[model samples]
Target chain A: MNDMVKLEKVVKVYGHGATEVQALRGVDLALEAGEFTVVMGPSGSGKTTLLNIIGSLDRPTRGRVLIDGEDTTRLSASSLSRLRLTRIGFVFQAYNLIPVLTAYENAEYVLMLQGRRPDERREKIMGLLRTVGLEGMENRFPRELSGGQQQRVAIARAIASEPELVLADEPTANLDSGTAASLLDLMAQLNEEKGATFLFSTHDPQVMRRARRTIVLHDGEIAADRHGPAGDE
Target chain B: MIVRLAWRSLWRYRRRTSITVSAIAVGTALAVFFVTMADGMYKKLIDEAVRMGAGYVTVEHPDYSRDLSIGLVVTGISSVIDEARRIPGVTGIKVLIQGQAVISTAGGSAGVGIFGIDPETERTVSPLADRIVDGRYLEGADERGVIVGASLAERLKLRPGKKLVLTTNDANGELVNEMLRVTGIFRMGMEEADGFLVQVPLDTARRIFGIGPDAATRVGLVLASPRDQSRVLEDLRRRLAGTEAAVLPWQAVMPDLAGFMAVDKGFNYVFQMIIMVIIGFTILNTILMSVLERTREFATLMAIGTSPLRLRLQVAVESLFLGATGTVLGLLLGGALSWYFQVHGIDFSGIYSDDTTIVGYAIDPLIKNHVTAGAFLLVGAFVLALTLVIGLYPSWRAARISLPDVLRSR
Candidate 1:
């Protein structure tokens, strides 16, 4: 399989002098295209930092990050933004949908950023919303929806632009157990049917059990990388 | 879509948005009221000053205003008056013989200005004929009577029919004196006129000042519309070319009133600036608070691939909506207030004396506001521009927030 993202000796340092923190310490990893992977770690183990560096949301202190074969470390801030817009999608732990926009607008945001035609944007966004089980709730704002529903809208937004990689950082952290299981099922279905690559960070055993590959992180370093059955199906 | 987003964002904090809009509206309304009142007050002052003695246009010898000497009289006065009366906007022309003199009665003596006017023609040029409070105005054939201002009469302890002696140097440089009976006492609410000016018949003044029948110090032309002064002056200047007289509009004749107008305009601008600054700060505070409160949301937008520039533009659009909404409301409220004042007027007699004068010209205590399209345009532009300028700081702050830091906080 072709590589979708590559990271070599990536180190991220926070603060300065005596208050410094080594969030990522010389971590090296690669994610293959079409892989349903999970990064599992305890709190402050640099799972989110690593995802940020790979997604071009943060600069590494010392390392090289490549996405779709282009070195993102050498890109300007504007170019990094362009890279994120065209090649990557992000789903945050809090399901950060814009509060003012309705479910349909939130889901269609990335497509709008891509400047797709209005009819195409509406069709693709509606299809994704339906796939994520939000078919009849298109006009409801984020405030009017449940935690599970908002997360589904966020997921639809992430895949609407057809990015090469989708990074979900504890997307189900705020949902109840049953909603979390349902959301995971929908994401897994999208991965299998559309050949979409998804890398999620979680410490939940339920999530790790469902992923085809699992990488464990300890103290800002990767401890083990293993493969298992794609268990949800 | 961006516009829709921006508009929707404003209503998210409904109370805050309404408060900001109200602040701008109140500020703009106050500005409109003050600007209109000041404009109307100044116009009233000018009208009163012109109607007091200085007609819309004045004709005099080149040095008459500065010297006021009887020797500086305009020759061939009847011809100049005839020419002036022919000008289209010129409604009436009257000859005036003005000179400084000393007036004495049994009780007092004071230096005063003497105006020699043709009562019949002066009636058409000035309101002095209608302002006689006691006794009768001068008549064309009555050459022995004079009208003294009320203050002058009180100071001299004289009444109508009392004899007063006036002394002045005539055109031949000889001191001439005349005993004249006071026919009327007039009060025009002006200190200069009520205290020190006396008007006599034109023939009586000619005899006392030793000037010829067709000679006078100046000619005052009255116009139907004061706005037509310039055109009539231009016509008079052309017609009276080669004569010994010079023609001047009232603004040239009364520099103090003209200068007051300029100063009043400057005061209006300064007042407007102060109001705008206050409203600008309110807008700045509101928008900055909004940015601070939505830091995480902004970061999420940036992570989702919105450029910093576009985010700033969205904030700017929000500010524009607030400014436009407030300006329209303020204009409506202010227009209603101005229209009410124009009809009923604001009575200042309770706050100030009824005889209050500004820069030597009497003004009515009751004032009505005058609104102009330019005032509305200026106030609207100022508020809109101020809101937009104030929006930039919050927009910049939003653009500069680090997405990673914000998300990590969440």
Candidate 2:
């Protein structure tokens, strides 16, 4: 499999001098294409920071980050933004959809950034919304939808542009067990059927059990990495 | 889509948007109203000044304005008056012989300006004939008869038919004294004119001043419309080019009033600038607060690959929506109010003890506002530009938001 993301000796420090806190300490990792992986860790264990560096949402303080074999750590901010726009998609813990836009518009936003033709964007967005089981609720805003529905719209948005990678930071943290299971099923179905790579961060045992590969982190370092048949997948 | 997003975002906080819009609307309306009212008042003042013997055009000896000497009288008064009458906009022309003199009675003595006018012709150029409050106006048959202002009459304790002595130098530098009977007492509602002016017949004045029968100090021309002052003056100047007389428009004769009008316009603009500054700050505060509240939302957009420039443009678009709505509403409201006041003037008589005059020009107590298309264009452009400038700060702040920090905070 082609490697999609590589982090080399990444280190992240917050604040300065004696008050500084080290969030990531010389972390090295890589994700292959079409992999359904979860980075598991307790609080303050650098799972979110590692995800941020991989997604190009941030730059590591003292290491190189590569996305699809391009060195993203040396790129300018604008170049990095373009890299994020064309190559990666993100889903936040809070299900960050633009409140003013409807679900359909929120899903179409990345395609709009890509300057896709209207008819093609419409076809792809409609298909994705249906794939995520949000076909009839396309016109509702985020506030009008439940947590599960909002996360589903966010997933549709993440895959609308057919990005190379999707980084979800605690995608199901706020949902009930039934909704979380359904969301995970949809994500796994997309990965198996379309070969879309997803790297998620979570501390939940149920979420870890649903991933095909699991990497455990403790005290800002990776403690274990393993791959197996995900339960019920 | 960006515009749609911005528009929807603005209405999300309905009460805050309404407050800002209302502030802009009220500020703009007041600016429009005050500017229109001031313009109308200035127009009225100019018209009144033209009617009070400073007719639209005046023909005088070249040196008479500076010296005021009886010896500097124009010799060919009849020809000058005839030429002035032929001008297209000229409605009337009158010969005037003005000199400084002293009037005395049993009660007191006071210095005054004596105006020699032809009663029949002067009636067409001045409202003095209509303002005779106590006695009959001067007629061609009444020789040695003078019209005094009510204030002057009161000071001299003289009534109609009472005689007073007028003393001034004739053409030969000798003091010439004449006995003049008061034929009328006029109250012009202007302290300068009422306190120190007395009028007599032209023939009587010429005889007392020892000049030729056709000689006069000045000739004043009235126009069919005050707006034609410059055109008529130009025509008169071309006609009287070779003579020793100089033609002057009323603005030249009343420089102080002209300068005062210019200063008044400056003050009006200062007032408008002050109002715009206050409204601009209000807009700035409102937009800044809105941007601050949406910090996390902005960070989300950035994370989702929205460029900082596009985010800033969205904020600017929101401000444009607010500004456009407020300005349009303000113009409509101000235009309607001005129209009502134009048709039915605002009466200020209750605010003053009596009719007030500014710089010897009497004005009616009722004032009207004139709403021109220019005023609407000016106020609209000003408000829109101000709102745009005020939008810049908030937009820049939005563009500079630290995405990671904001997302982490949320």
Candidate 3:
């Protein structure tokens, strides 16, 4: 499998001096393309930080991060922004869609930023919304939609551009169990049927069970990395 | 897309946007309205001052303005007036012998300023022509006819048909006197003019004062517009370069009035600036609040690969939109108000008596508005630029938002 993201000895420290807390302590991780992976840990275990670094949303304090074979550490801020624009996508736990834009517009934002033709953007966004079971709710604004529907739009946005990697940080944390399970299944189906890679950080066992590969983090360190059927663990 | 986003974002808080726009519009309208009214008042003052005293552009002996000497005279007054009349902007020309004299009757005597004017031309240029309250104005053939102010006539206990004697020195420094009949009485509502001024027929002064028929103390040129004063002055000076004539603008002739107008205009500009700055701060507060409330949304945009510059541009565009809308609306409302006032003046007679004057120039109590394109452009540009400048801080704050921190917190 092609390597989608690789990190070596990445460290993230918060605060300064006596108030310092190490969120990620010299941890190493790699994600291959088309891999349905989950980074599972309790609070403050650096799961979100790892996703941030892998998504190029945050720079590592002491280690190198590679996205699609390009060293993100050496890239300038603008260069990193361009890399993130064309190569990576993110889904936050809060379903961070621009409130002013409709669901379809929110989903089409990345493609628009990529300068795609409008018709192509319309086509892709329509198909993605349908695949995420939000086909008829394209015109609804974020405030007009429920939490599950908003998350669905966010997922469609994340994969709309066919990014090399999708980093979702507890995307289903705010949803009920049924909704969360449906979202996880949709993401898994996207991963398998469309050959899209997804890396998520969640404490939800549903996500871990749905994921093809699960890496367990404890206290800013990887305590275990496991693969195969989730039931085997 | 940026424009669409900015426009939508502005209307998201419709009440806030409306409030800010209203503040700017009202401030700008007040500035425009008051400025136009003040300008109209100034034009009236300058017009009355120049026409009642020296013309808009004057040609006199080089030292006459400084010394006010009867001996100082434009020797070739006829040619000076002729040449001035030929100038493109010179609409009317008059040759006058101006001097200090004393008027006396059996009851009293008072020091006065005498103006010898051609009655035919004075009718077109002087406000006094329209202000005769008694009898008739002087005629070119009535060399013995004189016009006395209402206050002066009262002090001298005279009537329209009364006789008075004007005593002054001739050009040769010999005592000369003339018997003058009060053909008219004029009330200018200004004490200085109404109490101390007398006008006589040009021939009578020339014959009595021993001035040559073709020579006079000053040659005054009336212009079609005040803006033509300088050009006509310059052209007159250039045409009469070798003569002892000094062509001067009315501002130079009446420094006190000029100085008053200058200081008044300065204060007006400062007041306008204060109004604009206050409006600018209102815009700043509204935009800053919008930015603060959308911290997480801005962070999301940044995370979605919008450049910091783009985010700043969006904010700046919002400010521009707000400023443009307000300025346009202000111009329309202010223009309408000014046009109405221009046609129907604001009556200030209750606040000010007809005797009110500024720098010895009589003031009209009914004030109108005068709108100039320059004034409109200046106020509009100032407001728009001020809003843009104030937008900088909020746009900077928008661009500088820390994505990771905001996302983590929100």
Task: List candidate 3 stretches off by more than 4 Å.
Answer: A1-3, A17-19, A69-76, A174-196, A204-206, B75-90, B230-244
Query: CA lDDT of each candidate?
Result: 0.86, 0.85, 0.87
Candidate order (lDDT): 3, 1, 2
Clashing pairs in 2: none
Lowest-scoring 10 consecutive residues by lDDT in candidate 3 chain B? Answer: B401-410
DockQ category of candidate 1: medium
Question: Which residue ranges in model 1 land beyond 4 Å of their true spot?
Answer: A1-3, A32-35, A174-197, A204-213, A225-233, B53-97, B104-108, B116-130, B136-146, B158-166, B170-183, B200-252, B258-274
Per-candidate TM vs. native?
A: 0.85, 0.82, 0.92
What shift in Å separates residue B404 of candidate 1 from its native position after superposition? 1.5
TM-score of 1: 0.85
* Pairs that collide, model 3: none
The sequence of per-residue lDDT tens digits that candidate 3 reaches over residues B26-47 is 9888889989999899998888
Candidate 1 overall lDDT versus native = 0.86
TM-score of chain A of each: 0.93, 0.92, 0.93
Best by TM-score: 3
